[model samples]
Structures are given as structure tokens and as C-alpha cells.
Target: METIIREDTPKTPYVKLDGEKGVVEIKGRSIPENSVEFYKPLIDWIDEYGDDPKDNTIINIQLEYFNTSSSKCILDIFKKLELLFKKGFKVQVNWYYEEDDEDMFEAGEDYQSIINLPFKMIEMEE
Candidate 1:
């Protein structure tokens, strides 16, 4: 599958889902006006990538902030990854949060609990 890359906007995150590289990264803030529309293509890309995923897939997420709607959209992305993991793909997530950002840390924790894949909570130094 071809890679999916999207530039970050004022209300969205920068996304890089490279099937060849076996890496996925989402950084910056996520507060798109239309959460579903903003994330649909990304979610769809993952769905297609699931068919013949790499031996190991690493997802790195470093969101400065996000809104409630974005939270749900983020979950959708994770769920797709979870399915790939369940199918025996070696999938892991690295959730990065700035040090002292309790909210972001807890949000990562929440996602870790909700998703069944391995997750590494990374703290970025201030």
C-alpha cells in the first residue's frame, strides 16, 4: 500500500503513515472542525494497510492537544491498529506527551487501557 501523508493545519495533526517504513506518526494539535471527515481517509488507509502489514508496525503519537471530537477520531485510528494486532501483526504504539502535561499523559493511559496493543508512554523533556 502507498503511504498516507497529510500536512498539519491549524486544526489538525500532521500524519505520516508509511507502509513501506512500517511506521505511523501523528504530531501537532488535533481539533478539526469535522472530525469524521478529517480522519476518514486516514482510517481507511489503515484498513487497507492491514491486509498486508509490515512485520512490525510502530505508531508514534505526539499531540500537543486535542478536543473531544478529535478524541473519538483518534480512537477510531487505534481500533484499526488493534485489529491488525489481533490478527498477529506486531503492532505497538508510542504515545508521547510533554513532561508535566498530566492531561496528555492520562489521555495516553486511557487509550492504552482501551486498546489491546502494546503501548509505550513516552515523556518529552521540557
Candidate 2:
């Protein structure tokens, strides 16, 4: 499987999905005008990656901010990871949030609670 890379825009995050290494990274903002359209390909890629996933999958999420629509799309991404985790794949989500950003930290906690995958809340220097 080829690696999926997408540049970051003012309304979207920089995405890097490496199928060979099983590493997924999404950094920057995520408030796209059409969240569903923006995230569809990403979700689909995860589905395809699931078919032949690496032994260990690491997901790093570092979003400065996201709108309501993006929130749902983010959850969809997590759900995909959960499926892999349930299948006994070693999966980890590193949720990075600015130390001073309470909302972002709470959002990570919320996702951790919802998804069955192991998540690590990382406090980034502001």
C-alpha cells in the first residue's frame, strides 16, 4: 500500500498515512467547509489499510481547533482505528494538545473514552 499524504490548508490538517509503517499523523486545523468530503478519502484509506495493517499502528492527532462537523468526522476516524484494535492489532493514538488549551485536552479525553483503542494525551508546550 502506498503512503497517503495531503498538504495542510487554512481549514484542514496535514495528513500522512503510511501503510507500510502503520503510522498516521494529522496535524493543524480541521475546520473544513465540507468536513464529510474532506474526511471521506481518509476514512476510506484507513479501511483499505485495515486489510493489510502493520503489527503496530500509531495515530498522532494534533489539531489546534475543529468545528462541530469536523468533530464527527474525527470520531469516524477513531472508530476505524477501534475496528483494527478490536481485531487484535496493536494501535495507539497520541493526542497532542497545548498545555493551556483545556478544550482540546478535554476533546482528547472524550475520544479516548469513546474509542476502545489505547490513547495517550500529550501536553504540548504552548
Candidate 3:
């Protein structure tokens, strides 16, 4: 499986999917004009990874902000991860938020509540 690495842009987030380690990360802001275009490959990658997953699969989400469309896409990502968990794969989602960012923290909590995977909410100093 190939890794997916995309640098952050003004209207998008930074994505780093390490296939070898089974760790995927999405950071920065995500308010892209076309959410589908931005997240299609990511969803596909997750699907493929889930098929032949590693012992441990961790998804690290550290977004400052995201639009409604991006929110749906994020949910889709979590759903895919849940599938991996159902297949007996070790899956975890590390949701990172700034210390004072209540909205981000709550968003992470919402996702945790919906997904069956082990979701850890992490508070970062920054």
C-alpha cells in the first residue's frame, strides 16, 4: 500500500497516511471548496487498508476547523475505521485538540460517541 501525503493549503488540511505503520493523520484546517474531491482518495485508501490491515491502525485527527461538508467526510472516515475494527483489526483514533479549543474537543467527543473504535481525545499544549 502506498502512503498518502498532502501538504496543508489555505482551504485544506495536511494529510499523512503511513501505510507501513498503519497510522493516518489529518491536521490543520479543512474547509475545502469541494469536500468530495479532497477526501475521495483518503476514503478509498482507508477502505483498501482495512482489507489487509496491520495489527494496529491509528487515525490521528488534529483539525483546527472544518466546514459542515468536511464534518460529514470526517464521519465517513470514522465509519471506515469502524469497519476495520469489526474485522478484528486493532483500530484507534487519536483526536488532538488545542487546550482552549472547546469546539474542537466537543467535536471529537461527538465522533467518539458515534464510532465504536477506541477514540482517545488528546489535549495539545499548542
| Number of the predicted model whose TM-score against the real structure is largest | 2
lDDT, residue 108, model 1:
96
RMSD of each: 0.8, 0.6, 0.8
lDDT score at residue 103, model 2, on the 0-100 scale:
100
- Candidate 3 local lDDT, 1-126, one digit each (tens): 899899999989999989899999999999988999999999999989887889999999999999989999999999998988898888988999999999999999888888898988899996
| Candidate 1 residue runs with Cα over 4 Å from true position | none
What ranking of all candidate models by lDDT puts the best one first? 2, 1, 3
Tell me each candidate's TM-score: 0.97, 0.98, 0.97
Order by TM-score, highest first: 2, 1, 3
1-126: candidate 1 lDDT, tens digit per residue: 788889999999999989998899999999877899988998999889988899899999999999999999899999999998998889989999999999999999999888898999999999
Candidate-wise lDDT, in order: 0.93, 0.94, 0.92
Q: Residues 1-126, candidate 2, lDDT per residue (tens digit)?
A: 989999999999999999989999999999988999999999999999999999999999999999999999999999998999999999999999998999999999889788898989999986
User: Candidate 2 has which clashing residue pairs, if any?
Assistant: none
What is the alpha-carbon lDDT for the whole of candidate 2?
0.94
**Candidate 3 Cα RMSD after full superposition onto the native fold (Å):** 0.8
Model 3 spans with C-alpha error above 4 angstroms: none
